[model samples]
Structure formats: C-alpha cells, structure tokens
Target chain A: MGFEMFAVFPGCTLEKYSSELKEPLIKILKYLGIEWIDLGGRCCGMPLLLSGDSESFREVIRSNTDYLRNVVVITSCAGCFRVFREYYSGFMVKHLSQFILDLGFSSFPHKVDLRAVYHDPCELIRCRVAEEPRELLRRIPGLSLSEFKLNRESSTCCGGGGLVKAIFPSLAVEVAYEKILRELPQDVDAIVSSCPFCYLNFKDAASIYSLNIKVYDIIHILGMALGVL
Target chain B: MFDNVFQTYKLRLYEAMDNSFIRAALRRAVDSFRINRDKALKRYSDVEDKRLRLIEVKKHVLSNLESYVKQTMESIESNNSYAYYAKSINDALKIIDEVIGSGKMIVKSKSITSEELNLNYNLKLKGNIVYETDLGELIIQLLDSKPMHILSPAIHVPKEKVAELFSKISGENLPPDIPKLTMFARSFLRDKFFKADIGISGANAIVANTGSIVLIENEGNARYVSNTPPKYVVIAGLEKILPTLIDATILVEVVSRYASYYMPSFVSIISGPSKTGDIEKTQVLGVHGPREVHIILLDNGRSEVARDPLFSQALYCIRCGACLYECPIYQLVAGNFGYTYFGGVGAIWTAFIDRELHYASLIAFTCTLCGRCKVKCPMNIDTPEMILKLRESIHSIKLIPEPIRQIIENVKKYGSPYGLTNRFL
Candidate 1:
C-alpha cells in the first residue's frame, strides 16, 4: 500500500472544546506513518446548514472547497465528516475511524487494561461507519469493547447536535444524562466515541451528574494502545 | 417575534422538565416502546419490503390524490355511506355540526385529526356532549390537556395521577392498580357508548378501492365507538387514502408493528352503515350497528404539502410515532416540542395543518436534526430533512431564534460558530 497525504479538518467543536483529542489524533496518524496536512481551523458549515442559513452555508462551503478541493479530507469531527460526505461532491472524505480502519491496525505493542462501551454518534451512524470504530477498538491490546442495547443504526443521539447545546443547554445535558442512565453498562470503565460533540457532551453530562465513568475519544484509547498518547 | 416564540417554547420545555413524574414516565414509555417495536418488527423478515411497498403505494396515492379522493367518495357512496371532502377545519366542523346537530350525545375514538379540528370543543359549544373513548384520550379530555404522545396521548401522566383522576370521576377512592383503574374507566365509558347518538373515529387507512375505513386499536373502544351509536362519522386526513384494501392492510400492519404492536387487538374495517336482509331477502339498513355512516376526508393544507417537491415526502408518514420515541429532544420535553402535533413530524404537520408557522418555527428548531426518526420510521419520512426545509422557510421570513441567528453570523464571519478569533494550529 502506498502512503498518501491527507488534509486534516479539525472542526470548530474539536478546536474549542475537545482540543485534547487533537494531540492523540496526530500521534496515531504519525505512528501509522501517514502524512497529513492541517486544513486550519474552520467551520464545516454544519452550524449554518443546521441553522437553515443555506446561503451562508453555501458561502462557507465555497471557501472550504477552495482549500479542500484536491485533497482526501480526514476529520475527527463527526459533524464535519457528515457535512463533507453528504454535501460536498468534488472530494473524498473519511472519518478518522474509517480512515484508520482502512489503513489497517497491524500490531498492538502496548496494553491498557479497561472495559469500555463504544457510542455510535448520529453522524457516523448516518455515514455507516459504526463497525470501523468498534473494529479499531478490538485491535487494541487489553481493551475490551461492549455494545449498547441500541447500537449502530438504532443508536440514540448524544444530545449535542443541531445547535441544541448552544440554545437549549439544559435539554441537551438532560438527554445525555438520560442516555447514560439508560444505556451505559454498569461494569464498563469508560464510554468511547470518535465524534467531538459526543465527547464534550458526555464529558459534561458525567461530571454534572456526578457519574463516575470516564469518557474518551476513540483516538485517545487507540493512541494508548500504540504507545503514542 | 423570534424572542417571543423562543421564550414561550423555552418556558414550556422547562415546565415539562421540572415535572419528575413526567420525566420518569417518559423514560419508561420510551424504553418499552423501543423494546416492543424491536421485538414486534423482528417477527417479520419482510418488514423492510412491506415498508417500501407501503411507501410506494402512499407516493402513488398522494401523486393522484385528487383522483383518489374522487374515487373514494364514489366508492363510499356506492357502499351506502355519505362521503364529504372538507377543504379546511371550518368546513369539517360545519359538516360535523350539521350531521350530529345540537343536544346530541357523541362518543369518539382517538382521532388526531379531530384534535386538529378542535372537534370536541366545537361540538360542545353547539350543545353536544362528547366523550373520548380511548383511555389515554379520555385522560387527556378530563385533564383539559393536549396529547403528550401521538399514540399514547397521556403517557406523561403517571398511574397515581390517573388513579386520582379516575377516583374523582368514579366518585370513589380508586386504587392505583392498573386493572382497577381500567375497569372503572370501562364501566364509566360503557354507558356513554350505548347512550351516545353518534360515534366518531379517525381512520388509520382509507381504502379508495373498497371505500373501507381501517382502524387499528388495542383497547376495543373504537369498536364500540364506531358500532354502538345510531350514526358514525370518520374524520381523517386525505393523506390516509390508499389505492386498495390490500395496500391499506399492509399499511395497518406496518403502523401496528412500528407503533410497538405485532397486531392491535382490534382491526376494524367498516365500509358503510350496518344492514341486513334477514327479514325478507331485501337489504335493509339500520339493523344492529349505526345506520348512518359519514366519511369526511379533510385536506386542510394536505394538498398543498403534497404539491411541495421538498416536503411532499412528509405526507408519507404513517403516524406510527416511532419517531417521537426515537427523538432525543422529544424524549426530554415530550409534546412541548410541538403545537397540535408533537415531535419532529409534528413540526411539519403544525406548519401545514395547524397553519401556524410561527409555532412550528420554534418546534422545528427544537429538533436536533438527528436522523434517528428517519431510521426508525416505517415510512422513512425523513423528518429531519423536512425540518431543515421548514427552517429555511422560517429563516427567510426572519422567524429564526436570536441564538441561532447569532451562531449563523458567527460561522459566516469568524469561521466558527463560537466566533473565536484565535485559531488552533
């Protein structure tokens, strides 16, 4: 297989809220010997599209298209991945989980013992990337992944999408809290997902509700397994 | 204007959230719905195929809705039933008023269309006594509250609250036991069913070919409501029209399965008034059941929605309400997220049927635009897509909430919704 350079699009949520996931994301890419270029900090027009400001959405799309027109775009943000995959036609886009799975997980040299459950973000589920993240998690040494009763296509939202957090903050947090209470396995040490919004929402929900579980971006766990975190 | 809408919605949402009973009840109901729907759907391997076929049939019927309406009326008339097309809520109310007259007793099954028409209020104003037959609906009727869920209207009300309400109605101390409460309601409503001068119901599907009104229900109240009275009326949306009885059956099955039932206890198919030839081999009406059957197919902006290229797909909804349980926002706030209708699909229905885009504007924004509703819908209505289209229309009219408008501005100007000047490199 030939190593190809891809452009990394760190969507606004990742930059603002879950910036810690960025370092491990870069570390995993480096360990995999993949060359990448940062597309710089930018919005993926998701907010505009969600807000029904299609005119501004188109404008943002045009601006981003100029920079990303010729590259295979990779992003850890599920919202960005969904926007590019569904809306943009001229370029190819892959969620970081899909990108990593396609690159293959050949060897696992380090062990981080933990029992975790994988949350399927609404965007990744819409994009049909449910299995790739789970497959990646299974490859890590000493990490066990369990399934939510409602997983994949049936997975519920993390209550962080469609600007809900910005407008109805309490409702968003309540949704996340209900999901944790109802869906999270009692024995799991952590909940993992690739989407930055899910990461931020779950993190906030767990802390606010005094839930003792840890929340992690899949990259963080993967980086741990590969000795890159 | 935007501020008022948002504030009103926020207030209602917070009120619903503060009610811990409603929160707990909603959680239990949502969990059960999920489990039951998954189990019910798993029994049939061809669920997807059936759903697709129903979608095709719905699309075909909606495409030629005017023709189907004509055909349905003709077929219904031929079956010795009166058929009327109501282009608006006022027209439907007028027709209903004329049929039942004043000082009449009426028993009604769960009809969201009637809710749309505010049928009970209008009929009561005309001096008619109206009773809701479905237990949940009866609960709502007593509470003077709107439905909390499309299928389970009073799901937000806990058993203790129901016992209290029923206790007052029964003039006795009714226990909080489910069976006792149910029996009390049954005995209480049973007399109304017999004494009622008219029965009204909403059809799950109306077969154009056979002129049959198909209704699926678990409580058996609809059977009494449609049969016991001397006159019966069905007020249903024109979108319920199906080309044939077979298509209607398939649709009913899909509706039941997605509504968390393998099959409802009663699947009533009524074509026309009850008649018999037992006397002298000559067919005579008014035998055992209602002698007069009136079918009113309501348009009320359904035709306009059907003509819209972007939103026409919304008419494909079977009203299974699988989406409401699946909706993250609806799970938290229940029916506060909508106006007349509730949940993501309700936003579209509110905008069109209720013709209140101002209210629908806030409801549309309440949705997370997560595709859970679409994935769960047997009709695959794409409520999120419809909501986006509705939002666009609302935005053009400058009905967007201030927070959303600011976010959009920030995304356009600062390249981030947060409007941060510093970039993470």
Candidate 2:
C-alpha cells in the first residue's frame, strides 16, 4: 500500500466506554503499513448538538477544526464521523471502513470461520458509508456476512443515536432489542457493528435482556481475520 | 420546571413501553407498511421524479401562499361554494359552529386538521353529534384516545382489543377476526352517513386554479362523508394548496405511494356543491350530493411556519405517516413521542402549529436523529435537521432534560460527555 498519513479520532465513547476497540484498530492500521497519528480523546460535540446547545457545539467545532485542519481524519465512531461531515468543513473526514476500503487490501492474513450480521449505524448509513463496511467484511476469506433485513439507507437504528442511551436508557435498550428481534436472523453466530455506540448498546442490551447472541465490533472481527488480535 | 416536564414525558414513554399490545401492533404495522410501501413504489418507476417535482410544487405554493389562498377562495365562490379563511383554531371553530348549529348530526372522514382544532370535542359540547366514519378513526373515537399514527390512527390497538371494544358497543360477542370487526363498524356507522345533516372531510391537496379539494382514501367512507349529507365542509391547512389541478394530482400520487397504497381506492375531486344544467339549460344545485359546500382554509400557524426559512419545509409534508413507521423512537413509544402529530415531523408540527413550545421541548429529545424519517419522506423534509434546530430553541428556554444538560456540562468541563479524561491514553 502507498504511504498515507491519517489521524485516528477515537471519539468519547470508544475512549471511555469501549477502550478494548482501540488497540485492535491501531494494530490493523499498522499491519496495513499505514502511517497514523492519534488525535487523542475529545467529545465530538454530538451530545451537545443532541442537547440543542449549538453555541457550545460551535465552540467545540472551532477548536477541533483548527486542530484537525491539516490531516485526513479517520474515525471508527459514527457519531463523530457525522458531526465532522455535517458540522465541520475544510477537512477531509472518513469513517474507518471507508478509509480501510480506500487502502485496497487484497486479502486477509488468516481465514476465520464465523457467520455474523452487520449492523449499519444510523449516522454512517446516512452518510452513505453502508457499502464500504460490508465490502470490508466481505474481504475476509472465511467470514460469512449476513445482512439485516433492513440494511443500507433503510437500516434500523440500534437505539443509541442522538444521546438516547444517555437520556432515555431503558427506551434505548428496548429499541435495540426490537431491532435485534425483528431484523436479525437467529442463526447468525454474532452481530457486528462499526460504531462504538452501537457496539456498546448491543452488548449491553444483549447482556441485560439475556439474549444468547454475541456482539462484536467490526474492528475486532477484522483484527481476528488479519491475525492482529 | 424542566424536570417536571421531562418526568411526565418519561412516564408516558414508560407506560407505552410496558403495553405489550401497543408494541406488538406497532411492530406488525411498521413491518407491513415498509413492505407495502416498497412494493407500491416499485410499480411506479417515476415515483422519485414525481416526488422531486412535488417538492418544487410545494415550494412554489408556499412562496405565493397568499395568492393561492386568494385564487382558491375566488374560484370556489365562482363554483357556487362558500369559502372561509380562518386565521386561528378559534376562528375555525367559530366558523364551524355558525355553519353547523346545535343538535345537528355530522359525519366526518379522518382529518388531522380537525384534531388540531379539537373540533369533535367542541362540536359535542354544542349539543351536536359527531361521528368518525373512517374505521380506524371510529375505533379511536370509541376508545376516546388520541391517534397514534397519522394514517393509521388506531395503529397501536390490536385486533383482539378491537373485538372487545366492538363487542361492548354492539351488545353481542364479536370475534377478533378483522372482517367481523370491520363489518360491525360499517353497519354501526352506515346509519350516520345517511342521516347526517353535514359531512366534513379534509383535503389531501387543494387546487388553486380549479378550486378543487382532492381527497385520497382507501375506505369508501370519505366519498360518503362528502356526498351523503345536505351540507359538506372541508377543513384543511393553507399549506395544502397547490397551484394547479395537475400539481394536486402529482401530490395525490406521491402521498398514496408513500402512504403504502398502490393506489387509493377512491380519489374524490370536489369542485363545488352538486349542480346541474339538465333542467332546460338552467343551472340548479343539490342534485344528489350536498347542496351547500364550505371550504375552511385554516391558517392556524401555518403562515408563520411558511415564513420561517428553517421550518417552511415542514409544511411540505402531505401527512403520509411513513416517517412514523421508520422512526425508532416512534416504533417504541408510538404517539407518546409527539404532542398532537407524532414522531419527528410531528415534533416540528407540534412546535409551530400547536404553538406549544414547552410540549415540543419534551417531545424533541425522544428522537434519535436517525434521519430515517427524512429518507422515507416523499417530500424529503429534513426532520432531523429541524429537530436539532427545535432543540436549540428548547435549550434557550432551559427546557432540556437534566441528563442531557448534564452531558453538555460534562463535555464542557471534562472534554468528554462521560466527564472523564482518556484513561486509554
């Protein structure tokens, strides 16, 4: 792969809630021979936007825009990716799936036999990043990808967007449960997501509701496939 | 104050969640609507083009709202029909009261505009009997419950509940079977249609050039509601006006397709009261349909919404209710997520039309801002964008929920919503 420098924006949820994802993400990038820098941890202002505090959101935007002006930023967090794409300008923003797809890897280092359904995060799907994540999952030789009944633009939310989990926690879990029951086939080995919020919500809901299904972030699956775990 | 509102709203949402009947009904309805809408849109390849064109048509009408309102009124007058402009909900109620006196029997098709006016309650207070002719609407009326969905008003009620409700009403044990329940409602409401002194219906689109009120429905109820009575009245928002009949036709098509109907069974274009020149070239009115036709063009905050750049797109909605089916929050809480309207688009409508900014304050936060509603809307109204904007207004008033306010404060203090530094670093 050609040398390209990228900044990895580990948004708040990934930094605080699902830090397990960070190592695998960095290892995958390193194994792909890409030069990357960590942008450190910061709030993406999505919570502020959700709370209707545009003034604070603008302040955060001003500081972050100035800081990330010079680099091609990549993030695994859907909410941060959305805030960057919609609220910020003059900087290139790419979801990690899009970034990985752009790098054009030919094959996975190892074949891992597993069947999983891909959950499209609302923000990334709306940003038209639906196909890229699926494309990345497809590249793994032995991993079988099943689709949610409502995928792509019509994908159902996992009930974690717009600060729902923070404010209306039970309602969010119920919505996540509905998505699982209605959209997911029972036969899949696991459910995978590209967004940290989605990953956390699905994991929490599965455990709380005592659902037998396992949940994994797409990076973790990729890490396993690439022998980087 | 914010806490009280948030608590009350949360209580309602929790209640909705606990109702397994609503959950089951919503899940089934949402699934059916998606499948039916997809199938309906697939039959017409030009649906997208028509939607884009309808957006332009709505934009044009909204820009020249006063002109269209004027032209439509004039055309209706020339067609021997009465036209009344109501600047507010009270004005609309007063007009209806004057036209429909005490002790009159009124049959109505489903009209969300009337819901905005609280028309049925006010009409009943004046010693008038009002009947909702649409089956779902009748079910809601009997239960004295607010509509849960725009098109499917009683969508939250399962068939078994309907059987129980109908069985009580009929003094006979009715089966949970759909056809039996529908037949019971039909036989019960059939009398009102024949004996009604007045018929009231809502317009899907009002034509400015032709002075026509276009009604789209699957149940034959609206046809009877408008034609069976001696007096007919149309209660519609001023935003429903289109420049021409052709524009209205396109809107009707778009609404039906997105409303999950291949084609609505009945499309009524009422130009005026029933008239005929069959008697030796002399024009005479009231042949078969209603003799007196009244068009109540309701402003009711729509003009204000149209004037505001950010909220003007909300008026482009045709009330197809596709967004409600697609909304995750709505799928869970149903109509509890909104004030009067329901779902994301309903939040915008509630804020502006209902003029209850405080209620909107509570309703706005329930949305996940998923943008699925916009994707499903035929008008492509960016509801999520409007929601954030509504939230900004709500935030200024300090009505944002405490937890959300905490998230904002935490972001400011800790550079993270969780109020913690990067432990991973």
Candidate 3:
C-alpha cells in the first residue's frame, strides 16, 4: 500500500455511539488527500479477551488480519490499535493520531480556539503510543493543551476499559469521578481522549457529576480544528 | 444468585465513596507509597533488572513448589524445628491446638495467612487469648474491622479514629496526636508480649535451602513476639517457599521495596528454635527465643492454584501490596473490594481459596481488567488476566450480570457492543 492508500477499522463504539467521530475523521483524512477504504465496524477482540474467550479472540484476529491484508490499517479506537498491533502482525495498523502525525500536516484550514486537556487512553499508554495522541493535539493551531499531573505511562485509567461500563457501571463511574477530580484541571472546557470508549465514559461521567465539560475523541477535536467537521 | 453479595458490595462501595475521609486517606496513603516506592527503587541503579530477577526466582520456585516444599520441610527437621503440612485451615488449627495442649496466651504479628485461616477468632474460641502485636492489626482487632489494605491493615481508619479507638482502650480521652496514639499502643502491647506463652507470625519467604523464614516489618513487635514467647508457631502458605536463602534475601529486598519503599526497620530471619551454648559448649533450645518452633505449611487450595496454568502466577505474589496502591478499584473501596485479601490479587486468591463460585464470581467481575496492577506488581502477576479467565468460567455458567450479558449478546448478534448498527438519534 502506498502512503495515500489505507483501510479504516472504526471499531465497535465508533460504528454506533461514536459515529460522529467517523465523519470528522474521514473528512480530515480526505483533506490530507489520503484515499482510505471504510472497513466498517468490527470487534477488535478486546471484549473477547475481557470475557475470557481467547479462542474467539484469536479467531476474530485471524479473520480481521485476513481482511486487513496488504493494506495500511488506520484505527480510530485505541483499543483496536492495541489489539491490531499487538495481537495481529500481518497488517501495519497505526492509530489515527499516529497516521496524521506521519502525514505531516503543516497547516490547518481553521483554528480550534479552545482549551483542551488530553486524556491518554490506557490501551495507548500501555502500548507506548501515548505521544502520538499528544502530538496530534499539539498540531491544532490556537488550541491550548493542559496536561493532567499524571499523564502518559502513569496516566489514570478513564474507568471505561475492560468492559467495566457494561458490568460494573457504578465502579467505573466512581473511577471516572476520581480521575476527573484528581487529574482534570477545572479550567478545561473539554476532555479529549484517543479512545471512543474513553470519550463515551468521560461524557457520561461529566453528566453524572453535572460538570460542564464536553468529552471528545481526538479525531473530533482535530477535525474540528481543521474545519473538516 | 449473588444478588445479596453484589448488594452488600455496592453498599460498601457507596459508603466508601460518600465518606470523604476514607477517600482522602487512601489517596494520601497511595501517594506516599508511590513516592516511597520510587525512592526505594532509585537506590538500586539496576532496579528493573533486579525486579526481573526476582520475577524469575519466584517463577522458578512456583513451578517446582513440591520439591521446594520437601526441601524446606527436610531443612526444618535438620534444624530441629517441627514442620507439619496442613491440608486445610481446620487441620492447621487442630495442629495448633495439639501443639499448645495447655498453653493459652498468644501474641501474633501481622499475618494475612493467619487472617485467611481466621486464626484469631478460632484461637479465641478455643479460650486462648490472642494479641495482635502489629499496630495496624491491633487497631483493626480492637475495632473488629476487616483489614482494608494488605501492608497497612488499618489504612482505612483515620488517625482520629485510631485515637478514638485507643482512647477507649486506654480509659482516657486521647488526642488525635499520632505519636501519642503510637505510645498508647506500644504501652498496651508491651505487657502482652512478655505475658504471651506462644508467638505466631507469618513467613514472607520460607527458605527451602536453610529451612528458615524471612519476615520483614517496621514494628519491633514482630521481633518481640517471635523472641519473647517460649513457643513459636509459624503459619505460612506452602507457596511461600524460596529455593535458597540467597533467593529469600532477594525476596526481602523485593517485598520491602514494594511494601514500604524502604528496607524495613527489621528483617527477621528465623532458622529454627533459638539455641545458645554459653554456660557449657552444649547447645540448648529456649535460650533466648522460643524453645520449640513449629511451622505449619497450609495448602488451602494452593495446590489447585499451582495446577492452574492461567492462575499459577497468583502464587508469585510476595504480598507487597504494591498492586493495592496502584489498583483503581481498591483506591475507591479499600479492603471492602475483597473478602479476605484486598485488590485484584486478593480477588484471584479469594476465588481459589474460598471455593464459593457465587462469591468468587462477584469479586472477579468487579475488577476492571486494567493492566496497571500488572505493571506495578513486583512479580508481574497478571491478575487482570487471571480475573478474565475467572470471568470466562463465570460466563460459561451464565452467572454474569444481566447488563453485561446483554452487551455480549449484542456484540455477538449486531456486530456492535451496544447492538445498534442503525442510525443514532
């Protein structure tokens, strides 16, 4: 695959609850003149791993790898990026943030004049791709980024990983509440994260706590800054 | 099926969340531990290499647990100390009863193994007055509260609460001053140590080569308990064995680094019954420490855990409590997150030892499967992986929460986690 050719793995949340993340993401990629195929929605086998169905997880990875063969795969979800890069080796799977960084965007069509704090997804941090998301955020003109005291490798979990939201919502909410209380600056308007699961969780938690904060996937914010969405 | 357990767990969680004091206390404790852990690790320039070496040592020991146990038992016999294998908690208690015969007073240092066996309650029922010598354990023993943290048993209790609990025992109004509280506990426990007929302590690492036990602690009480009593009983898990004293020494470094981030105030290495040949060139037991040192190696499903390929790493835990301070769920619920032990590692151990499927299911599912515990663990025990394996077993039984089941089914059917492939509102 050439630099312009790519296949997109939007992941489960991106296909459904976070479809809004897709349009901005696609627009930004199109703006960069990168021709990409929409591989549509697919399970990244994380839920399978979480549920202790490694057999099914392996089977899923095998088939996903077959579909993603001979293509540069761009993943919107940090969870998907992790499973693809770690578990599947056939395709060159890169996080959308890392892909954008590689594209080397020198200027944006529009500046996103908003103060945002970058929340590192646990999957990305654990995989050592934390810098990619931060670099993506930094490229946005007129956007000021405030970091949590605990960021990168030591960054707190967004309380959304490991399918906790489905089974242990209360515990997940408490975790999110604690992370926000401890890490988030009170002045930030938005909590920008690289994972859809994290985005959904922070958004839910913001409402639960009645905090006037908007949560966005990095693609959404970056796309907004580029006047793509 | 586990509705009541989940209810109780949620109640405790909500109560913990509501209690500002407990949350703040946990945060402060974790911050200090993390800082200290970093400080302690900074002392060793090759800290990561040391951790990897410790991991290898534990892995090798766990894989050949039976051989190590045999070696440890033989070494203990050679040292003239009695070693017995207890198949169960009841068997261990029975052995203790037989050993004691007529002895009553007991002073015990901090031992999660003893907690696992509920030794204090059983000893008390047998009419043996048992005193917990560790300050945290003593505080919880007085308050009749379960241990919230592994290393710091009474971490959930604030200083003012400790002051309150101590004041009641002292029969005087005590200020919330920490030093005053420490003095009260010290004065209260000093007599018990001298009066106790037997001392019971847990082994951090049981050296198979020398048949010795290494105990790391900050308080002088463990030494007092082990040294002052005429008879000493060590109740340890069979999984505590190390191949040699050299390995055990390394473990002491690992445990202390992970536990308190400092080489503890004392690291007690007890080989056998204390012997002295001072008056004559003839050795005699009961010279300074205990006359008879009886070691009861408790199995209590450790063999079953060892047999399990997925969860065998659970045995690698040195009980440093590093995972607890690093666990997100534990930071919120404290000890209430688990039954006997605390955090993700505790959940795995409880699942194996408790033998109740419903109980284990509830505890196992509560873990978020975050890998922070894995990163922070000295042994790199993949507790989240173990929990997931437990969850998989639970999933087979269809005991998973309804909401979770729905999501799983949704993902299976609709190719989306939420089960909606259609347009969103």
Candidate 4:
C-alpha cells in the first residue's frame, strides 16, 4: 500500500459531513507529494471508551492496531491525532493543522484573511492532543486570533456529546449555538474548531438564523489555503 | 398575557431585585435552603439508588401516561373521588369552576399546576377568597408575586420585605429576624386549617393502582389542606403519575433527599378522600379526608412536549429544583437570567412552556454549558444540551426576529461569526 498516513480522524469524527475538506486534504498532500491512504483507519472509538464500553472498543483497537504498523496516520482532527499520540502504539499520527505549519503551507497555500476566535475543543486541549493547532494558527501570516475568556479545559461543551444527538438533537443545536455565541467580543469574524463534531454542530447551529457567528473546521481553513475548490 | 409573562419572569425579577428587599429576602431563605439539601443528601446513602428507581418509575409513567391516567381516573371514581383531565389550562379552570361554583373561601396548598393555569386570579375574579397554606406559597401570595424558585416560592423576597409582610399580615411590628418572621406566619396559617371550605393541593406523585396522591412537604400544610376541608381538589400536571404505591414511595425518597429534607419529612398518601367501608365496604367520602376530592390532570404543554424526543425530558423533571440550586450561573443571577424558570436549563423550559419569550435567546447565550448542572441533576437531564437544542429551534423556526436571522445567514457565508470586517484583512 506504500501509503504515508500523515494524520487521522479520531473516533466520532462523523467524517461523512465534510466533502469540502477532502480534496484540499488531498491537494495539500499533492503539493507536498505524499501518499495519503484516507480510509481503512479505524475509529479511535473513544466515544465508547469514555462511555464505559471498553470491551468492544478494545476489539476495535486490536483490529485497527495492525493497519497503523509501519505507516503514519494523518488526521485533520486533533482528537484522532491525540489518540494515536497518547494511546495507540506502532502508528504515526500528526495533526493536519500542525503538519501544514511544519510544511510552511499555513503561509503558502492561501491566506484566509479573518480575525476570529479559535476554540479548543475539549478533547483537543484538556485531553492528550497538543497545543500545536494554536501555535500553528498564530504563526500563519495575517490570521488574527483572539482567545475566549474561557477556553481549553475551561472551554464549554456545545451540548453535542455522549450520543446526545440521537437522544436529544434540539439540545445539541441549542447548547452548541449558545457556546458559539458566548464570549463575542462585540466585533469578531467567526468561531473555529479542530474537531469535526464541534465544527459540524456549530455549523448547523450557525445556519439556524439566531446565532450570528460562522463555524469552520481547521481542514476547511486549510482547504481555503491549498487552492483546491 | 404572554408578553407580561416574559416581563414577570425576565425583566421584573431584576426590577424586583433592585429594591434590595427581594434580594435580602432571597438571601434569608437561600442559605437555609442550600443547607437542608446538603445535610439531607449527606445523611442518605441510598439516595442515588432511590433517585434511579424514581427515574425508572417516572420513565414508565411518562411512557404510558395515557393508560395510567385511565387507570387512575377509574380507581378514584370507584373510591368515590372525582377525576377530570384538562387537556389545556382553560379547561382546567372551567372544570374547577364546576366544583367551586361561587362564593367560596379557599384554603389551598402549593400547586404549580394551579399557578400555570393562573387559577387563583381566575377564581378571584369569580369572587372566591383564596388563602395559600404552604408557607413559601403564602409569602408569595401576600407579596402578590410569582414563585422565584421551585421549592421556595418567595425565594426572591428578602427578610425585610418579609418583616413588612408579617407586620401587615399579622398586624404585629416584627423585626426581619428569620425565626421571628417564620414563627409569626406559622401561627397565622395554623388557624386557616380550620376555617376553609375547600382545600386545593398538588401531588408530588400519584399512584395509578391505588389512586393515591402523594404529597411530600416539610411544613405539613399540605396534609392539613388535604385533610381539614370537606372538599379538596388535587390539580396536578398529568406527568406526575406513577405505576404503583411502591413506585410512588421510592420517588418520595428521591424527592425528599434531593429537595433537602433530612428525613422523609411528612409523606401524606391520601387514597380516595379517606373513604372507609366498614360493614359492606360502602365507601364514604369525608371520613378521614375531604368528602369530594377532585383532581384536574392538566396537559396544557406536556403533550406537545411528549411528541418531541428532545424536550420530553423536561416533563421527567420531578420538580426537584436541585438543578436550579446547583447551577453556578443560577447562583449569580438567580431568577433574572432566565424567565420564571431561571438558569440555563430553565431557559429551555421557558421556551417549551411558552414560545413567545424574547429574553430566552438572550439568556440562553449566558450559559458556558459547563455541564455541571447535568452532573448534579439526579435525573441526568442533560440540560446544557437541551438549552442548545432549544436555541436551534428558536433560531431556525422562522418564528424568530429578522435581525437574528440575518446574523445566522452571515455564519454560513463567511467563516466569521459576527459578520465583522476582518481585522486581519
């Protein structure tokens, strides 16, 4: 397969939601000219792990453990990146955001000229994920970022967790938009997240005509950067 | 009326607080209230088990409320007590009128359903004298105000105002000393037990099999209200029913511990108005309880809630108000943040109970959604998430205002949230 898996999407990424970020992910790969095996990466299955369904999750981990051998797992999601970095053995996982920064593509592909508040999704900051996304975004020329009064571990949930969506969908959107709208500086462009669940939930909430903030995944920002439609 | 409801719940709470009397009165009760809950839960080890059982009981009742209501109505009728299901608030008031007719001095216990139905004002218009026997309720009644918190009705009223109320109600110039004020009210309400013709109370839980209405209160006013009068009316929201007395008893434990009762304070299980059949089991009303016991099972907004998977859990709330006290944001703003409901979870409730509220969206944004309230909530109500869902409904429903809609449109088009000119640009 000779694939250089540079990143991974963590479990519960619900990757089906984003067609916008795929080609750009591939384009950035094409620009860097690295082999990207986008699929067959098993879900980190952390949602089940956190919910106390570790037996099934261990089975998943065992099955996926073989795939990561001798290959780098590249992920646009910080959650996936954190899982591989912290838990999984015999795999290489680098976050797409930091990878772009390392590749100097944060400056090269496109400059998304916006002053926005970057939110650290719960798992991304308090969990094993690195602070590299923040470090990388700050380095990107002309990408102005402001900190929320409360972020990182102190950051709020969008109310879209723990199978809360299937059980309670309205609450997911309600709390997501609430957290998104909180800490508005009276002047800011939008809210951005490293997690796709947060990104998508916040995006749907943003579309609801009550919240005035836009939501974006980091890969989408990179999509804008890499000049892939 | 809907507009005033928003004012009463949102704006007026702050306006009432500005006088400092409300704040002082609230502080007087708040500490004591928090202490009771802390002490009670500490004493009870199996409290969580009880809560879980209660949750299971409530789940069964809510899942099969239609059949349970049918069962409850039949049993009460057999026991010579009457049952009327009011699908709406108006219907409940009308049914209440058939029982009361006119010229009645009512000694009622605490009923949030009655408050929801606005029955006191309706009955008062019909020229009936109504006195609230629940100590907390009495304070709110004397103040001519609404409940600020669920358990403590006059939680917003400070002691100075209570002193003034005691001075006016008792005709004795009393100081704002909390014990003194409480003693005065106790003496005053102890007398209302004997003089009232009709007693109206709310059931904490109702058992379908036995047709028993369970009341859990610390003050025993509910017991007096249900027992002393010739005719007693139970006006409960339809969501209160449980399957059996055993299940209802388990819920009583949860309610007591979570509501901050050290021991099961006073559990009154009234079955069909105290009817006793001696020789032939000829059920007689008004033996140990009220002769004519009428229960108005209200639907008003509960059934609409039942249709939605999201908001239905709000009905599952056992009226514990533990969520309100545990809320960090609620600790700061109290009743002002949300409407009559209060706090982040209350904002979702306000939307469900009444849709026209404007402050709900404004208040919804106040929560950090730290998930602490859900952590403390015994039911695991997931209020933070519920608030978000309500926000979505409010935003996308086309019923929201245009400016808010424009703001949402900006999020989809630009990556920026506020539609601002990018400072980096």
Q: How is the predicted docking of candidate 3 categorized under the CAPRI scheme?
A: medium
Interface RMSD, candidate 4?
13.5
In candidate 4, stretches whose alpha carbon ends up further than 4 angstroms from where it belongs are A1-229, B1-39, B276-284, B338-340, B354-367, B399-406, B423-425
Q: Estimate the TM-score of every prediction.
A: 0.95, 0.95, 0.93, 0.66
Query: Which stretch of 10 consecutive residues in model 2 chain A shows the poorest summed lDDT?
Result: A1-10
**Candidate 3 DockQ vs. native:** 0.50
DockQ of each: 0.62, 0.67, 0.50, 0.05
True contacts kept of 1: 0.69
Q: After superposition, how far is residue B102 of candidate 1 from its true place, in Å?
A: 1.7
Superposed model 1: Cα runs more than 4 Å off? A1-4, A27-35, A226-228, B280-283, B423-425
Tens-digit lDDT string for candidate 2 (B1-425): 75777888898999998899889998889879888999999998698999999999899889889888999999889889999999999899999989997899999999999999999999999999999999999999999999988898898899999999999989999999999899999899998899999999999988888889999999999999999999999999999899888888888789999988888999999999998999799988898999999999999999888988989999999998888888989988889999888888888889889988877877788888889998889998999999999999989888888898888888888888888655322
For candidate 3, give the lDDT: 0.82
Global lDDT scores for all candidate models: 0.88, 0.88, 0.82, 0.67
Encode model 1's per-residue lDDT on A106-216: one tens digit a residue: 657899798999999988888888888888888888888898988998888989887888888888888888899988977899999989888889989999999989999
Name the TM-score of candidate 1.
0.95
Clashing pairs in 1: none
What is the full ranking by DockQ, best candidate first?
A: 2, 1, 3, 4
- For candidate 4, lDDT tens digit of each residue in B17-42? 34455445544454566688878888
lDDT tens per residue, model 1, B336-404: 888889888888989988989888888888887878998888887888889888898888888888899
Q: Which model, 1 or 4, shows the larger TM-score?
A: 1
Model 3: clashing residue pairs? none
Lowest lDDT 10-mer window, candidate 3 chain B? Answer: B416-425
